[model samples]
Target: MTTSAILMYVDVWIVLCFYGYLLKIKKRIGFQLGMNISIVMGGMAALLSGVLLITQFPFHFTVITMISTVAGLTVGAVFGLLFDYQTFVTGLTNGIIIGLMSPMIGTVIERPTMFIIFLHGFFIFSLLTIFHSIKRS
Candidate 1:
């Protein structure tokens, strides 16, 4: 298997282990904590998938990045839905924004820039989710 594929597996294991620990301490984590972790996990998965796409394609790099971004957003939306309704809205919004900007902003093969964009999306979505949750309360 490719290195990126291997890294994906490793990331999945890490997330699973971390969530398993959270499940053990769900009482302490509470809703907000769980929500934050869910966002982080979704974001990290997106970043990793972006990296994987880059590593695998390396050519037609722009298209690959865009494709990866779409894939990442799809995954994030799925995770958000699983997490909660607010997160679902946040993820979908974030994904749509990022997917639209992917072609324009990070067209080059700069991993750092791509990561930053992914992180930006993560933070924005998290903030929106939090705000919505707080408003609901």
Candidate 2:
């Protein structure tokens, strides 16, 4: 696998493990804590990814960065609202949208290979599942 693909896979795995841990301790802050943490992490990931793309890639930054930031904020806010509003369905729907958009955004910014996109999607969906399980439990 390419370096980027490996990174994406590893990132996903890390996110899954982290989210799992949060779920385990979710009762302390209430069940919604895991979801809250995930949203923050996701937002940070998007921001960091955007910064990385602008710094490391050949892409234009002006529009791409703005788009990425907006996307990140939207996803993050939706995630937060999912927990705050106690709307699991809304969260899942937003997750689905983010999952679909992530790879496309990744490609547009980083131009990663197909494998990278697959890995990205896999991790994102995994994160969604983790949250869903936490909510159900």
TM-scores of all candidate predictions against the true structure: 0.53, 0.41
Error of 1 at 62 (Å): 8.2
Cα lDDT of all candidates, in order? 0.56, 0.51
Q: TM-score of predicted model 1?
A: 0.53
Error of 1 at 136 (Å): 24
- Minimal lDDT window, size 10, model 2: 87-96
lDDT of 1 by residue, 8-106 (tens): 576567556654654454454445544555555555555555555555555566676667567556655664555567766666556545554444433
For candidate 1, the lDDT comes to 0.56
The runs of at least 3 residues in candidate 2 whose Cα sits more than 4 Å from the true structure, single-residue gaps closed, are 31-34, 38-87, 110-137
lDDT of 2 at 87: 38
Query: Which residue runs does candidate 1 get wrong by more than 4 Å?
Result: 60-83, 95-107, 110-137
For all predictions, the C-alpha RMSD in Å is 6.9, 9.7
